[model samples]
Target: MDLLVVGGGPVGLVVALRAADAGLTVTVLEPRHGPVDKACGEGLMPAARERLAQVGAAPNGHDLASIVYTDGRHRVSAPLTRPGLGVRRTVLHAALLEAADRAGVQVRHTRMIGIEPGDPRDHARPARVRTSDGQERTAPFVVAADGLHSPTRRALGLERPARLPRRFGLRAHYAVAPWSDAVEVHWSRNAEAYVTPVADDLVGVALLCRPPGRWDPTWRSFPELAWRLAGSEQTSAVRGAGPLRQRVRSMVRGRVLLVGDAAGYVDALTGEGLTLGTAQAFAAVDAVLAGSPAQYARRAPALGRRSTLLTRGLLAVSGQPAIRRLIVPAAARVPAVYRGAVHQLAGGH
Candidate 1:
């Protein structure tokens, strides 16, 4: 294989499909297969939706034109000038997997446990991979799409922990049909809930907050959201993910490169995690085909800066009550600026 991609999540499958499209052989390694689930906002930015279409991986989901942020008292709603979609994580994964298969990218069920960098003395030599089956494989280039807690990153000394306070997320799907055409982000003093319509009769709710101190059945903090989801039966079990901030030392080292959340992550506050990862997959494959893997380090992050900034900014405000109080009101006051910000974050800038 010309490329060995670790972690067959969205980004990994993306790299495989894109690389194969570029006429390069590719193999993806991931232990778990099928419709894998995770805690995610589950809303794709407009740019991401288009890119997936270009690569033949667009999945079926509800259309989302706008984003509405409400603190119960104050609210800011901005329509996307570009196209965006609300799709379940499993559905998205299945689409990408189908695309990869169609493109002839090999899918392996084994896991990559370790990597041995190519020697500098032999420029043509490929890196060696140790698999879960205790077999070794070699490839000219390797991509670490393993995700936020990437073992490949730590094994290569690329971990860089951020100073920001840790936050976690929990997600579940409700059987109720969506009541709104746009994604609704309900903000409160203690937590923020993201409501994304993934299907005609299924909406996914992901809750973000500091870990709970004690179990409480009542969601008194977010009365409006609780009321809407009150008696709706849950279609999926609650899935959690966190310590949402991940930092990295660099994206490229020797024959290995980090893509998607494996490269770095801030928060899902901006709902662009998969979008930026899709962009990175494009950059990484192009760099590999150009025989200049180092270029990806400089290019991929540039494609994601706007989303990263917005994510960090939102996290900061969400952590501070005073600023949190201002978000909706400020956006409401300057609708033009808020719309421009939304467009910019959508990669339309």
Candidate 2:
């Protein structure tokens, strides 16, 4: 394989498909056989939609719309203006995997055990990978899109930063018409629930907060905003997602690169995780095909900074009851500010 990618998640699949399209022989190694169960809000920003279209991997039957934000007391709505899609993670992954297969990229249902740095002079000798099933795969470059707690990243001696203050997330889907064409992000102190309309009849809801030591206590602490929606209808059971925390630093190391949550992830507040992953996938693939690690290295900081800013901003707002009280009212009364903020939340910024 010209490149060995560890993790068959969305970022990994996108990397494989893009590289293959660029005429590179790519192999994706994933521990899971089929679609990995993803706990995400499952909304794609305009930029993400554009990237998918560029790669010819856009969803066929997905719903497209903007997002709406409310606080139960006050509400603001904005038309997407640009293209955005609300497709389930599984559906999105299936499309990417199909595209990878069509592009002649090999998919291996095996786990990567370790990665050792190789000699820079010899492309083949620079990176060596070991698989859990005793299979060894070697390539000029290795990609660690394995995710937030990446084993490949650990094996490469990459440093993991201290976990962020708040560390947990809960997400699920419901079968109901969205209150508006735009995604609805309702805010409350200590938490925020994002409701993204994936289809006319289905909405994706996710909550993020501090994790409790025990399972029962964790679910108990999660704030329930979906149930408070003005005219919400019952459709699906509530699902839980994560103890996801923000990662510090860049996502690149020598010939090994990280994309999506593997590199660094922000809270679900901004709804930019999927967009960031898709963008990084393109940048990484382009860098690999062009034989320039520098290109890939340059792309992470700006995106990472933005993610951090958004996450912190949301945390700040959600943490202070007074701030939420003041801001929510101001946002509702100020249409321009409200629209811009909602646009940013939709990952337009």
Candidate 3:
């Protein structure tokens, strides 16, 4: 194959689809079948929505028109310049999988143990990967989209365990009519409740907190979020992910390119993972098509600069109780600042 993409998540499939559309042979390796689920906020920024359309993975989902920052008493909201999608992760994955198939990208069931850089003499040969069943495969190019806890990235010796105060996210679905078109972020002293309208009749609630058992209790820390979700029957089991941060040394080494969370990640405070991953996948594929894998290393991080800064800033504010108390109030005092940030985040530039 010209391109061998590891981890058939949305971003991985997107890489394969784009490469195949560009007339490159592509194959995706994933252990799971269709509609794989994960703990995600499930809100796509407008940029990610556009990329999904470009890749022909047009999945229908609830429309997100704005973002609301609130602390129950204080609230600030800004309309999106471009609309976004509040989609279930499984639903989005299924759509991307179908699109990958239509693009003639082969999907294989296997687990990648690790990646070994290809020989220096054969620049066209891809790094080798050992599978769970003791099978090895090599290709001209490889994009790792295996996610935050990626084994491929570990094997590449590009990761360092997070040393900062870490947090995790747990998500569950509630069967209820969406309260609003805006994604509501309910802030509290301990954790923040991310409420997203994933369907006409379903709202996905994801909690970002330091503690482990907080998710099972259902918004107990944030009374405002709890009240809104009160009496809404839970529709899905709780799923979780990460310390919410992964550090990487680089995006490219030899013929391998790290895309999506597999590349590196910051806190998910801004919900920009999907957007950044989609952009990186496209960038990686473009470099592969140009026969210059090193180009992706320079381009991928630039794409995430805005997102990283915003997320780190927000995480810092949220970590400080005094500053957290002022966030929504300050935003409300100056609506344009909030609006401008929202517009920029919605891909208005």
Indicate which candidate wins on TM-score.
3
TM-score of each model, in listed order: 0.95, 0.88, 0.96
Q: Give residue 168's error in model 3 in angstroms.
A: 0.5
**Of candidates 2 and 1, the better by lDDT:** 1
What tens-digit string does per-residue lDDT give for candidate 2 at 89-155?
7778888887887788889888887777565446656678888889777788877888867777677
lDDT-based ranking: 3, 1, 2
Candidate 3: 10-residue stretch with minimal lDDT: 211-220
- For residues 234-319, what per-residue lDDT tens digits would candidate 3 score against the true structure? 99998989888889988887888999999999977778888889999999999989877778878888998887888889888878
For model 3 the local lDDT of residue 272 reads 84
In Å, residue 310's CA in model 1 sits off its true spot by 2.3
Best by lDDT: 3
Candidate 2: regions farther than 4 A off: 60-62, 119-124, 213-239, 341-349
What is candidate 3's TM-score against the reference?
Answer: 0.96
Could you tell me the TM-score of candidate 2?
Answer: 0.88
Candidate 1 wrong stretches, greater than 4 Å: 119-122, 213-218
Each prediction's RMSD over C-alphas, in Å, is: 1.7, 3.3, 1.5
